[model samples]
Target: MRKASIRLKTALLASLTCVTVHAWGMSFERQERCIEGLTPKCQVMILATGQIDKDSPKQFKSFAQTFPRGTWVAVSSPGGNLVGGMQLGLAIRELGFNTTIGNSDYSPPDCLSACAYAFAGGVSRKLTPGSRYGLHQFRGSDQAINAEDTQKISATLAKYLDAMGVDRRLLDYAQMTTSDKVTVLTLAQAQLLKVDTAGQTSYARWKVEVTPDSKLLAINSSLFTVGSQIPITLGILPVPGQNNKVACLIYYKSNDASAFSASNPQHFEIGKEIYPLISAGNWQEKTGGYQATFLIPDNLLIALLQAPDDTVITLSGSFSKPPQSNTTTASTNPLTAYFGVGNLKNSLQALLKR
Candidate 1:
């Protein structure tokens, strides 16, 4: 078989090997890899949904900083703030994270709008079988847009797809789509569109660290409870650090603080990956300041619902690196990243009502 598309020259990272995933439509599991026992070139940095602002270059910087030389980033979003997608994509491309697209750790995937735009940035991107990506007729609004605006979005997307070396046929189809035809690419289609670079990249050997004040920190928002499968973003940084490993850590807190559960609480870590197919534990420093994304699961909805409304998610984490904790993703444009938070919440409510 052909080697993966990753082009890193680092000595520590040799393409390990991929353990074939035979789970086909078995459970609709969103996370393609649990990563607990598996290894990768490095940990998959994640981004939160609807957090990045459109046309915001700062988002680009945020990702660039987290894993300056990371293997891949998992983008979880309902879509919004796509303007900065171009800049963010460029940043990912420049940083050598050109091997594969990132995947969510806890929740199932439903990437949309700007999230998909950023997804197109990987050197060699792919999606799980059930992954869903959406494209609307308008660039950023639910209101009616003129034909010219639609054309502009199309051209912009075309340029980006081309930059990622996407097949012309897929780009052609995407470019011509009208509002009447919202485009969504399934995982199977993503494979055909984005050439397979599966076993090519991992964050096994990047020069990362956990400083006392690393700029990028994990956003384990305090708005969710246990069993709540939430989609989040893992911001990567590239600044100097104590060790040549990935920064930050992800931890899940159960109702019983006395008990810690890896399967119950999903953590997405950042560090030099173990390539080919590495387990989540392959990297050192399983706890403490690290680049792991801790999210809330949906199964805990009942417990949360029993509590008062607007129950804030209880999350805690730390940052270690240069004291740039205030160092936001550098961007020239104002941003307003959007996600289906409202939609998701509504859906959850509707399910509750049912």
Candidate 2:
């Protein structure tokens, strides 16, 4: 709808409809690597490289079945089949996987045109340093397509981007360039458009609210998990009728129905200290996922408040089980979601003044 010149090529549409033998499509390969972190552990990584076609999403789902949910998917593609690329992105997002623009060897690679759509699907998208994320106008195979059809395709693409938390302005950037050329975005621009989210741990800032009792105070912030960016709200509220006393809790809500399990071990980590969290015994099952709460120890809550503003607090839990394999010992690698204590002290001080 933006412009009559912006159109999808019938060739790409044919790729999705016809049952013809194309040269080659996307390939999904699995590899195991020792991930270095608080605990050095062996993790399975998926490498998706090649042209994204109609079959790519299916291929990815099949290949990803054996790996854990937070597994990394490194993609390197020149782009193909726009609809197929969006479908592949949806699959990635559905599985709660992380995406990056790279190859199996971890070399920076180009994720251009339609491939960018698939990249957008990542829960945590990272553009490798030196990697190129380019977009351009869609091209067809010399088939005449009407304006109405093109507008529909554009609208669908816009909706997909919005669902993925990407800026719709990305489409404007794509339309600005012709299909024959690519418009590669700089790191700053990519971050501005939310195509990349490296080092972005918190989704929401600290918000202070008055409890229903009026005398008690509640402060909450939304922190995201490391790989998938699963939102976990950290809430600190005064204990009822306990003067200068507060209780802490973490609330996890996800659209993925299986996102959290009561049996899984969950904890909060600050520096060398590990504080275990127990289920608050409150659970609500929603349409697609569940919402649950975990209670934080009073000591941990005090530590969090006293800690430096730049201190990073991790919310870890065994969210997924490892695949059964002889080469790798099956272990529950806890999800390492963390957030910095940015201006929390100031917010608390301001709240007290209020």
Candidate 3:
């Protein structure tokens, strides 16, 4: 019985090795498309498919030399070789190419496990509605991997993801999933995790609601922020006692010991105009963080509504140090929030029609 058990283990190991070798064999193909209208133009499209191996990066580098920067690379793979996938992703990024999950025929394709890492290298990563991006726990290629080696590998992966500007929670999700099972990400999940870097319009939308006083409240709670540790909410509503004017309300959260204060100078930069924002009141302590509100002028709110969908509105403020008893010196730190106006006009128009 002992001999039989040893034989079975050896056979299973051999089988796994064979499967890994076959899966690691990746291919690179170049496709061309041209417009034959009044002004003819041609472009090259790269189709990268199959599992990633140690040599995949070198192969891609050689193939990419013939194409120009900003070329589109469509990939379809079941994933293989974690390090190889990361290396391929670096190469793709270095070449300044865009990436999507699909085949040459435009059929729905899967970028799973290591393939997802490779896809992250794109200057602009795009995952269509029908495509799949999946993750799973990392598995040792050989049975001899020790815990120390595993830790090193995990640390390396974390570093790679950080460099790619992806949230580390993605790696946490992958680690929590079993190796035999895959965790597929939805479009919303991808956007929230910073996996979809293409700046899609679906990230934010405007919605309307009626207040208790029978007033129309047009709110866009999905405002995106940068250079800030807390999430911010933005809304537009009628100014109290003013019939023709509307005010923009901005809400943000901060920690109890945070340097943010109502006395800090705040302003909004809408297009080329800068407008001062008045603080609503004192900060209210909340479960996770302290909440504060600011109001934007009606003219600035009109400017925001008239701006293009791609316009980026800026909210700037300063964080001042707490007053000291013995010292008269104080320091101020600058903070800014940037959010795009996406689907705002159409959504507002649709809301008003109701």
Highest lDDT: give the candidate number. Answer: 2
Q: In model 2, what is the error at residue 76, expressed in angstroms?
A: 1.3
TM-score to true structure, per model: 0.40, 0.55, 0.48
Candidate of highest TM-score: 2
lDDT for 354 (candidate 1): 35
- Give lDDT for model 3: 0.63
- Separate clash counts for every candidate: 75, 1, 0
lDDT of 2 by residue, 258-284 (tens): 334445567878888998876766446
Give the worst 10-residue stretch by lDDT in candidate 3: 1-10
* Every candidate's lDDT: 0.37, 0.63, 0.63
RMSD of 1: 21.3
Per-residue lDDT of 147-213 in model 1, one digit per residue for the tens?
A: 7755555565565565455654565544455534447765556667663344332111112224377
Model 3 spans with C-alpha error above 4 angstroms: 1-24, 32-43, 104-108, 200-354
Q: Sort the candidates on TM-score, descending order.
A: 2, 3, 1
